[model samples]
Structure formats: C-alpha cells, structure tokens
Target: MEKKYPRLQIAKYVAADYFSAMVSWILFYTFRKKIIVAPLYDSVGQDLNDPTLIMGIVIIPLFWLLIYYLSGEYHNIYKKSRLQELGRTIFITTLGVIIIFFILILDDTIISYKNYYQSFLFLWGVHFSLTYLPRLIFTTRTIHKLHNHIIGFPTLIIGSDEQALQLYNDLQKKPKSAGNQIVGFVTINGGPKTPLSNHIPHLGNLNNLIETINNQKIEEVIIAIEPSEREKIQQILTKTKATNVMIKAIPDLLNILSGSVKMSSLFGVPLIELSHELMPAWQENVKRVMDVVLSSVALVVLSPFLLVLAIGVKLSSKGPVIYSHERVGRFGKLFNIYKFRSMYTDAEINGPALSSKNDPRVTPFGRMMRKMRFDELPQFYNVLKGDMSIVGPRPERQYYIQQIVDKAPYYLLLFKVRPGITSWGQVKFGYAENVEEMIERLNYDIIYLENMSIYIDLKIMIYTIKTIMEASGK
Candidate 1:
C-alpha cells in the first residue's frame, strides 16, 4: 500500500530538501555576517532581518531545489541507493556551490580572494552536510521499510516451472527483500501443469498481459522461464515492451559467466533487468528543456527564413506550402508531422512513397530545400508542440511502418520514443529509398536509441549539419 502513496513520500523528500536548503543558507549568511565581515554589523551586533538575508532565505532554497531537480536527485525517490545518494549529493552540492559562488558571492566586497575561498568552502560544507543528512535519513528509513516488506513494488512472475517456483521462493524468503511484492503469477505456456500453480495463483497468459498489468497495478515483471522455453522470451518481451513496468529476465549459466548477473542483496534473486531507460534522468530532462527552448528560439529567430521558404514552396509547387502527413509517434500514437512541401501536387496520388534522388515530382526548389534541410525547419513548431523531438528516430508512415515491422519485428521498439526532425538514421543512412534500405538503416537508429545521450544527439546533429553542407542526403 505504501507504493500507492508515492506522491506523499515524494513530498517528504521535497519538504526535507527545501527546509535543509533554507537552514543551510541561513547558517552560511550568519557566518558571513559574524565572521567574514564583522565590521559591517556594528559593535552591538546587527538585526537578523536584512532585506538581502530575507531574499536569500526565500530564493536560495528554491535555487538549491532547482539544482537538485536538474541533477536528477529528486526522481524515483523510493528507489534511491544510499551510497549513490551520498555520492550524487556531494557532486551536485559541489557544483551548485561553485555556480552560486561565481554568480552571487564572487562580486561581494571581500578584503581578499582568500576570504572568498574560505566563504565558499564554508558554505559548501554547511550546505552539503545539511542537505545530505536529511536525505540519508529519509533514504535509510525508506530502505528499512522496503527490507521489512513495508514498501515493495507489485511484481509479476512470468513462468510456471521449477525455475520460476525456486525463484519465487528465493525472493520471498530472502533475508533482505528486493522490494518485489509478488502480487501473483502469469504462465506463458499455461499454468495447469506447472508446480507454481500449487503455490501462487496464475493471473493469465501473455495474451492478456497488458490488461493484467493494468488491472493488477503491476510495477515490475520477472521472467524466469526455463531454458527449454527460451523461444517464448522474445514473444514475452515484445508483448511487454510497450508497458511502463520494469522487465527483468532470469539469468542462465552464460549470463553468469558473462558477468550479466547483478544482485542487490546477498540472498536476493539475481535478475537481468532490462535497461530501464535510454538516457540518464537528468539528460532526459535537459533534452526536453533544450527542445522547448531551442524550438521556441528557432521559431522566432528563423521567422523570416521560414516566410521565404513558404513563399518559395508556394511558387514552385501546385500544393500547400506546408505538408501535414500522419506519422506514428511515441507509443504508436499518430500525429500530423509538418514539413515544407517538397513535391508537386499529386506526387503521392498512387499511394505513400519514399522520394528518390532524381524524382521528377520534387521541384528544383524542393531539392535545394531538402539539401539544406530547410524542409524540416517548420518541424521546430512540431518540437515546440511536443509532437516531435529535436533528435530521435525519424517517424515512418503507417504504410511503410507495417512493411518495416514485417521485415524486422523489432522496429516496433522505435515507437517507444518520440520521432525526431533529424535522426541517427537520417544522418548516417540518409533517406531510405525502399523498405530494404530502411530496414538496413534501422540498425543505426536502434544503436542511437540504445545509447541515447546528449553527446550522441550532438554528434548526430553535427553529422546532419555536415550532410546538409555537402548536399549529400538522398
């Protein structure tokens, strides 16, 4: 039931951080007033109600909170590791202190630079100590509750053989709980013949997984199917890939030998947890922030350029300046993708088709626009609208998507994230002329998705710019 109270627990962390930040700032200010610049306070010691102090008390805590949030410290509050928390707190606090020093305290009227260093070190120490202490306390208490089974994720076990039974017993009887509350079990090959049915109730088969997960409020899924049933793993994974729950598979001898097994506790069942997310939480947050900011700025600054592009397309083509076409977006949701019209009217009257290098339907002006990526500039509006990202797997139309999925079932994984204006595929392989080339280009996008980080996005963008300059894309 504690899992159901996530917001309440999250509020506790935020509240603790807010007050700790406030107290740390107050203490730092007091030290500055009393020791660093004692002459300014007069012989009688000054009133503590200065406007600057009041402002710091109000705004500085918010500043620290913002720092913590952007550093990814406040996310997944219940799943925090104490050791990791300590390390992250120290790192983020140090960074925040440095930023604040440069921005605020560096301009202070200090007698010497030595005093500035002292003030900075003192403030950092106080802030780090105060902030980390409460976090450690809260995290420790939460971990204690988790270990004692007071707070646990609602996990579903998928398998009904001896392996699954043993895994269930091992996790259930462990000295320290792995925080998986086995709500029930699901059998991939039917539950009647399996020994697990004698113990836990079988919820349903893989056919009803999404519904079962939703109805049961499942948070995690443990895949412990036997080696003989390994073929079912792909089907299981495909079915569960779209669900938000964490997916973990039981490791085999090869996995153990390859060092794939990771145990959080001494007796906890080892699991090969699927990589939970593509990028660090902070990078994901920062990417979204950049998307909004950059798209907004581009829309404003490139207004004149967009206007000219629109006029050119209108004059050169017998169609609307902007083309709106349906494309599958994140989680298979369809959205209208906007682009400058790069083709004449009735270019796709036969059906949806990929453009070729020498397609006559593409106007000369349109080809120039494609070479310069001016056709995609309007997608900044799509990014601003949250229908697309600045960088991701380029979305495919349903007609092409069906063909791609038929050739490579894993293409469905691309739907997990928002489509981008420029992708690793587009940068590396350019526009695919056919389904076969599209499938070949799919590998790079998959690589990009697997190792998605800001660095990769920047690298793809650099390549895209080079491609545009070279006029190399098909």
Candidate 2:
C-alpha cells in the first residue's frame, strides 16, 4: 500500500544540483578561456594551463554548496518560492564571484587594470546566469504543475466560526492558479456556527486536530479564528507551532486593505491573506528535483544492503519481511508506508501500541534494525512514489495523532506538507515512547517548519548521520 506522505523523489533534486553546478563551472571556464583572456592578448589565446585551474572548477562548486547550505537553500526542496529563491541565488552567486576574483582571477597575467574588472564581471555573469537559469526553468515547471493541479499540498482550515467560513469561501473562489487546495476543516471550538459545515467536511472538533490531519492527509492549515479568541488562538498556535505545516492567519478586511498581509488575492469575491508560504515556487521545484535524484541514487547504491535486510527479516520473523501500514501524509491523505518488519507477525494483536525500548514483541534482529533505522530503508520507495520526503516532519498514525491533538490542537499544522523519512524531530528526538513524548518532540519539528531552509536540512542530515553512526536513535 502507498503511504499518504510519500517520500520525495530525491534523484531529481540531486541531479539538478549536480548538473547546475557543473554547468555553472563550465560556463565560467569557457568565459575565462574564450572571452576575457583571449581578447586581451593574442599570445594569451594559445593554450594556457594553470595547475589550479581544474581544482578551481571543482572547488568553486564546493564553495557554492557550502554557501547554499549556510543560506538554508536545501531544506524543503518541494515548497520553494521563486522570487525568494532567485534573490538568494543572486546573492550567493555574487558572493562566490567576488571571492573567486580575489583568490583565482585578480592576480592573473593581465596587462591592464581594466582587464581585472572585466574578468570579474565576465565570471560573475556567466556563473550566475548559467546556475540560475536552469533553476528557474525547473522551478517554473513545478509552479505550473501546482497550478494545473498535477501537484497539490493538502490544506486544513483551523477555525470553525464565521471568520473560518469566510476564509474558506474566499480560498474556494480563487483562481485555479492558486497553489493551495483545501481538503477539509477542523473546528477549533465544539462546532462552528458558520456556513462552512454545508460546504466542506467538518472532519472533527479541535481536540482531534492531529487525528483529523492524519486521517485526511492535510498539508496546510489556515487559522481563521475570531479576534476575541486571542487566548484560545494562542493555545492552538502553541499546539501547531511544532509541525512543518504552513500556518496562515485570516486577517480582517482592513488588514488586507492596509497591506499588512504579505500575500493576498481577490477571487471575484472578498480578499484573503495567505500569511505564510515561505519558499518561492521555483525553489520548491528545485528541491523536489533534488529529492528525486538523490533518492534514486541511494536506492541503487544501497540495493545490496536492502537485499540483505530482506533476507534477514525473512529468517528472523514468520511474517513477510516487508510491512506496509497506514500513515498520514501531506493534506491529510492516507497512504500505506513501507518498512522492513521490525516486530513479530502480531506484535500489536491487542491493538495499536507504541513500542517500548525493551518491548518483548520485537524480534532480536528488529532491535538492531531499529537502533540504526534500517527498518526505514524501504521508505525510499515512498519517496520515489512522491508520498514523502527524505527530510520533513515524520508522519504518524491516526491513533497517536488523535491522542496528540487532544492535548495540542495545533498538531494539525503538520498536514501542510509531505511527511519525511527523517526529520528535524527524528534527528533530535529520535522515536517517541508515548503521546506525551511525541508532543515534546513536536517542538523541534515546528521550529523546523517556521525556519525551514536548506542549511537547516544539511545540519539535521549531518546530525542524523552522527546519530546513526552512534546508534543513538531509539
């Protein structure tokens, strides 16, 4: 069965990053060889070789990667915003070129000082243009897909009153090009005295938000509570503040008119402000492409280990080696998540149960596998299938999600994006032993969501690797 939070296609994203870097480097080299130096002196046109030339080509990309990571460019590859991404790309490219000029190109055998500035300009133009062009193309295609409904993030509305209904109606009337597609509404109070009940499914009360999000596969949550419920709103926000979902506030019409809203649109009806959607359309596309490429490579490279795990599972347990179970994904959709079975055939015969560190039902091999997260390898298939990501908030089961939402209404926010095989929470908190523990870890995930960036993802990845090497995950 397919998981609701399908893993991201990591291969595409890795390929994009690799190719873009290669192309940018090549362009820089060509410009230096064929344009800048060649035009300056006839003798210089002949073959000129520097030992560091090749190294510079290779090293430049390493620098770019470092800068990109520092700039938080790699996180959430699927949800980038084009404008912001372009701005970042330009900044990084310019910085890279300036550094290159002083380190590699400035002290060149130039006859005139004018040549120094010319060379710098040439390198910067070629590198930035080549790098950003491919990124733009890839991102544009993704935005198109989102608008065409070929791809959509599952969204949830957080309020049940008149304001919530107003926001829902406004979003529904928006042009198809709007990126979001609302799945359903989770009421904040007992039952909203609003028109939304007739238009959309009232998934459940606020107390069951996490459960509703898991069951419905929600991706984004729009908080449209009334102004009077400030205290209650804060409580809801506190609960949801931990997940990676997009949280947008429904501002009053005056706020919209006064330009306090960052993003808003008129859909032949009243206007609404979409407060948070951090990345640009293009960056999001680039991120997806990277995910697909990396995941594909990982699957191939780790095939041998996967085979061994399957064999081990077969020998260690009586049931099938691979276990598929329901999981909540982006937009509250349900999908079957794949994993190497880590427990006995009927480990949970009583019902859904959280595994303890020394659970008796676990197979001997399963214990080792859980420690190293080997049981999660098969999830790469989910990434390939576009149900999850390599990095994001980890998906949860409906049972525990309901439990979490009872105490934290904001747990519903996690439904805004695809779940991940590894997340900020997983890297920091590992596995949760119970509902309370899960809620505790939810803080890290929420922080990740609000401060999502490529740099943060790399840090998490590095930490995750460290955890795995030490067998620190529980």
Candidate 3:
C-alpha cells in the first residue's frame, strides 16, 4: 500500500528546506559581519547579536519557504525524480540568491566590489548544498522503498486486450517497480475474459469508470488499448475527466516523434503521460491570488456603479436586485453563481432558457446591460468566494449543461477548471443563444484550457475588455 502519510513526507522536505534556509542565512550573516565588516571596521562585532541577524533569522527562512511553495516543490513528494529535482534546486537557488542579493545583501558596506560577487556565490553555494543534501537523502530513501516494493501507488489498467496483458507483464517484470501496484484491470470493450484477468480482478468497464476509480482509490490509470483505437482512447479520457488520477497511455511512433510522450520512469515501459492539469502550479497559485485581489478591488471600486445598476434593475423591472442560479463548477461541484437581474422576475416561468438578441423576456435596461456586461458585475463576488476565477471557461447551468453534454460529451472537461467571469469563449463567440452555439463556443474554451497560463489569461482579459468597451457582447 502507498504511505498513508504523504503529508509527513512533505513536512520532512519542508523541515529540511526551512532548516537549511535558516542555517544558510546565518552563515551568510556571519561572513558579512566577520570577513566583510569586522575587517574593515574595528567597531563591528563578530557576534550574532544584532537586530539585523534577529530579523533575517525570522524572515529569510519564511521567504525561502514561500519560494519553494510557489515552485511547487511540495507536490507529489514521493513521485519526484531526484535528477530533475537537482536541476530545479540549482535553478531556483540561483534565482533566489539573486533576489536576496538585491533586496538584502547588495547595499551592504564592502571593502571592494569583489565582496559582492563573493557574497552572491557563497550564499548560492551554501544554500544549495544545505538544501539539496537533505532533499537528496529523503528522495533516495523514498526511491529505495519504491524499488523494494515497500510503497506503491494504486494503479489501474484501462484495457482488456493483448496490449493490456503485455503491458501488465512488462511492468510486473521490470527490474525496478515504478511504484505501480496494479490493483485491477478495467475493460474497454465487451468480449471474452482477457489474459490479464488471470493476474488481477476485473474492476468493471467504461460505464462505471469514475465509480471504479473512486471505489478503488485509484491514483494512476494506464490506458493500454491499441493506439489505432483512437475512439476508445477518446472515450476513456472523457470518462476520466472528473478523476484526479494521473493518466498514462501506450504511445505510438507518431506520438513519440511528435514529442507528446514523456518518460515517467527510466526502468519501466515507455508510455505517454497524459496531463489534464492545464497550468503550472506557480501560475495557478498566482492566478488565484490575482483573482482575489482584482475581484476585491473591483467590488469596492464599483460599489457605487453597482448600486446605480441595482436601482435601475429594480425600477426597470419587477425583481430582486441580485440574481442567483446554480451552475456546475470545477470537478462537477454545484455552486450558486451571482449576477444582477437582467431579465424580469418571471422571465423563465415557462422553463429555463438561454437569452438571445432582442429576446422579449429581456427588459430594455437588461438588453443594454447584457451588451455592456454590467449584469455580470456581481460575479466578482463569486470570484472572491472561490467559486470562480477572473478568467476561465464560462459555467453553464446544469439544465443547459445536460443539453450541451448530450451533443458533446467532452463538455464535462471544462469542469476540470473553475468557471470565470469572462472567458475566451465569451470574448470570441459572445453569449450563446442555443446549445449549438454553446458547443461552437466550447472550441475556444477547450483551446484556452490546452494553453492555459498567466499570459493567456491576460490576453483573454484584454480582449474581454475590448468587448465590453465596444458593447459588442451582443
């Protein structure tokens, strides 16, 4: 079984980093005080009793910890590759040293400019050495445990053919276990029992894929179906959209040449690791920070405008100032999305419906608000509430989501990310008046998902601003 305490492993690394940072800072301070300052000024003491030392001791370690967190060092601690981690440590350590030099060290009194260079190099070397040694030891211990089968991730094979059998055999026969404890196999097509059944139990098929993943606590999924069965591959991926499992598949020559596949283990069979996560961890965290900050500012800055709009809505039509509706969010969770009422109170008396240009249900003030998107102002609260982001795929009500899913099953993939106040779909395609248009808009959202980053988000926001200024959302 996998270690039940992954947090303990993370804490071990964090403790290592924090301890190393404190020690490195102290060493750098001593070097500055003794070699740099005391030699030049007799009044300067070599003792570590200064307020500067006290402050550095308190702040520098926390600063380094925050950098490590943003660098995503704590994620999937057991699955980290030591070689890759070494490279990452060197790069990040150099970058952090530069930052510290400018912010904390560069202005120090020095005998010559040579001291600055020496200080930078010494800090980088000391920090890197202290940080990497303990990390290397921890990682080596985890890898040794994995190789000895002392710990393993719960893995499931999503195929039942000869390819699946061969994959199972290859992984089981590997000189070192890739930590894949092949718990069972799931069938893709209905047929006779596969050869793999002799080794592992059949969990179920695609119909109950999500249920099986949840019930079995699956951490990794390997799709062993033939590459030629592209439809099956698509189907398997679609069903696993809501799962948090790491997905890998047997790759063809084309995929390899296209650089779509990456090696997860040197000792295990070659396979393409499919990544559903769209953005890097640092950018994802930064985006959330931006969402909170921007949304908070927007709500505060636009309060008077919001009040005016609320008054207009109440006077223009008979309904509450705010409108709320349940929408499907990330991981298929349901949350109430907020908006200023843009339609009459009984606009949807017949049933739920999508608004269109010149829709009779839309009040005169509502149409103008939709064109300028003032009605969406309240959704900043949703962003602040963590139900949405400032930029992402637009959320759809479950009523219309089911309709959209009927035509395009991949729509659920959008649920992998939080819905946003404005999206590439809204920027390019504007509001969708029908399910078909929503599907059409989904192409842009899907593209946005594949290429998500802070840069892409800023680009989308720029275009969304243009749309609002031009009143072109119609």
Candidate 4:
C-alpha cells in the first residue's frame, strides 16, 4: 500500500523550493539594505519596489531550480534518505551560494570587505534553512509512513526453501517495516509447494520470472535462495538484468569483506543491493546534454565534409548514399542506425555477414572511408536523434546480437546503454570479422559498461581518434 503519487510528491518539493528560494532572496535583499547599505549610506536605499529586488524575486528561484534539476535533487523523491539529503542539501547550498555570490552579490557597494562575508553567510544560512526545512519535513513524513508500514514497495521473494521462509519471517518480525511489502514468492527449484506457500502465493518458476514481475507490478525483489542453490543465483540475476526493479540478496561474509554490498538500514536484513544504474544521475544528464550539443555542433561544422562523403558514397556504388539498418539500442529497442554506405548494393544478399579486411563487398572509396571512419560520420545524426551516444558500445544487428548472446549471455548487459558511433570495443578490438571476434571484442565493452563515466567516455573517444588517424580500423 505504498503511496504512489510520485508526480504529486515532486510537485510538492518543487513548489517548496521555489517558495523558499524567493523568500530567501527577499530576506537577503532586505538584510543588505538594512544592515550593509543603510549603515554605509545612512539610508535604506533600495525599496521593495526596486527593479533589482523584483528581478531577484522573479529569477532567483528559477536559477535555484535549474541547479537542483542539474544536480538530480528531485530524483526518487519518495525514497530519499533524510541523512543523505541533509548532506546533499548542505553541499548544494554551499555551491549555489558561492555561484550566486560571485555572479550577483560580489560587486556590491559596502563599508568594508567584512560586508561581503556578512552577505554570503546571511544569504547561505537563510537559503539553506528555508530550502532544507521544507524538504526535511516532506522526507520525514514519507520515512515515517514507510517505517510504520503505512507505505511500502511491492516486493517479490525469489526463492522457495527454508532460507527463503526464514528471510521472510525475519522481515516480518522487524519492529519497523523496511518498506518491502512482500507480494509473493517465485520458486527457483520448481519443486512442490514448500512452507513458503503457507504464507504467500507462489507466483511461478524462473521460466516466467519477468512476466510475473511485470504482471505483479513488482518494485523490489529479494533473492533468498538456500546455500545449496547458490549456483542458480547467476541465472536469476541474468533474467532480472533488464528489469527496473530494485534487486537485493542475502549477503555472505565474502560479500561483506569484498565491499560488494551497501547497508541501507541498521536493523533491517543486511543484503547486497544490485544496482542497474551504469552512471550517476547527474552524470547521465550531463552526458546526454553533451551528446546533443556535441552532435549538433559536429553536424554543423562538418556539414560540407558530410556532403562530400554523401556524394562519394552515391558515386562509388549503386546503393543508397546513406545506409540505414535496424540495430538494437538501449533496453533492446530497435532503431535504424545511419552510416555512409560503404558496401555495394545488396552487399548482404547472401545473408547478414560481418565484413572481413579484404571483403569484396566493400567499394574502393568505401574501404578508404572505413579506414578513416568517414563512414561513421552519419551516425552523429543518430546521436542527435537520441538513438546513440558519441561514445558507447557499438550497436549490432539483432542477427549478430543473438549469436553473441548465445556465446556470452552477459552481452545483453550492453543493451543497458545507448550504442555509440565509436566505442571502447571498436577502439581496442577494431571491427569484428566473425561472431567469435565479436565475442572477443565484447570483453572490452563489458569493461566499458562496468566503468561508465563521462571521463571514461572521453578516454574512449581519444583512443578512437588515434585509431582513425592511424587508419587502423578494418
């Protein structure tokens, strides 16, 4: 029975912040007039009706809102941890105050340098208090509801054994609810109904795990399999890799010592929370912004070059100037990936095949374009269209993807991110001539997935540039 008004909660937080930001700016304006300016000039010079005061009242809150949005402050408002939020608020408050001071308050007329410190401290204190107090109130109410079992996440248990039953009982016996409202249990062993069936309905076996998760609107999953069934844990994790639900499992001493798990509660069952997030929220936002901006700029700056490439492609072969093929993208969604055509018309008439170094399907100009990676220039459009990034794992045809998945099930993990025009895989392993080589290249892609960041992406782009300069792509 968790309160599911996420939009409503977000609105509350936004409204609270907007109101508080306006109040803080007004109070700071008044303080500057009364304490700083009045003493120096023997007058409260700026009245409430001043244009600057009105402007601050109008625009300052919006400025703060932009900062909050970019910092990812509004994400998962219902699940916010008060202690974590306190730290985040303080940090962001300090950052915003510094920015505002330099941009808005630094050049103020004052009696001494001490006035600058006074204005900064006063504005920061008021803004932080006004902003954080309302947030604390909202978050505290949500936490109170969760702890009291008035609200909870729809949870599923992913095992059927003595261990699963014990874990279920432990959560039930907790003095304060950890917000996991166990909806049911899914059997892993496919055995007859066990003691767990006495407490909760058996949803199904692993064959329909994802279907069951979707059908039940599951928000959380706990893998509570017995020690004897630990080998099946990888199968369970792989099945749930594409799901958005939060996944947790009972941790062992090895997990604890290896620092693979994070503790969310002091009294609740300790478990290893499996996060599907490849990058932090703010970084993801920034990456998308960079993708759009850089792609837009590249398209504009390279328009003439792109035109020449299009002409070359049209003349080199009877095929279309731009080749568009359906490629699997983020979350297994299909999108037509664009590239300057580098092969003869009907190049894959024999079947979808990976190009080799001396492939006859490649046109003479196309071979040069591939060497210099001019063939990939058109994918900047894909990046702008949101189907890809400038840097990520290269997208593959579903035919090749199926073959890759058969060899390495974890290859599906690559679908978690947008395909890129240039990738660490392409940079490190170059073009794959066959499925075996594609599997060989997947290791670097997996490494990139595990270590995704704006920094890592920039590094991959640098390496890719070097490969293109050396004409190393095949």
Worst 10 residues of 2 by lDDT: 1-10
The candidate with the higher TM-score, 1 or 2, is: 1
Candidate 2, residues 154-189: lDDT per residue as tens digits?
A: 788777777877777676666664556677787765
Q: lDDT, candidate 4, residue 52?
A: 90
Error of 2 at 350 (Å): 4.4
Preferred candidate (TM-score higher): 2 or 4? 4
Give the clashing residue pairs of candidate 3, or none.
none
lDDT of each: 0.83, 0.73, 0.86, 0.86
lDDT of 3 by residue, 87-154 (tens): 98999899899999999888898889999999998899999999999999998988988887889998
Best by lDDT: 4
Candidate 4 Cα misplacement greater than 4 A, ranges: 2-8, 39-63, 144-151, 173-176, 214-217, 252-259, 275-277
lDDT of 3 at 128: 99
RMSD of each: 3.9, 8.6, 3.1, 3.3
Which is the winner by lDDT between candidate 1 and candidate 4? 4
Q: Mind giving the per-residue lDDT tens digits that candidate 1 earns over 1-474?
A: 465477787788788889988999888888887788877776433437687888999999899887777777767777888999999988989998998899988887777779898899999999989888988998899888888888889989888888899888888678898688888888877655678887777898877887888899888888888877777777777667766777777766235222123443324566776765777789987888889998999899999989999999999868799999898898667899999999998998998888988999899999999888889998998998898999999988999988987889788778778899999988888888899999999999999987899999888888888988988876
Q: Which run of 10 residues does model 1 get worst, by summed lDDT? A: 253-262
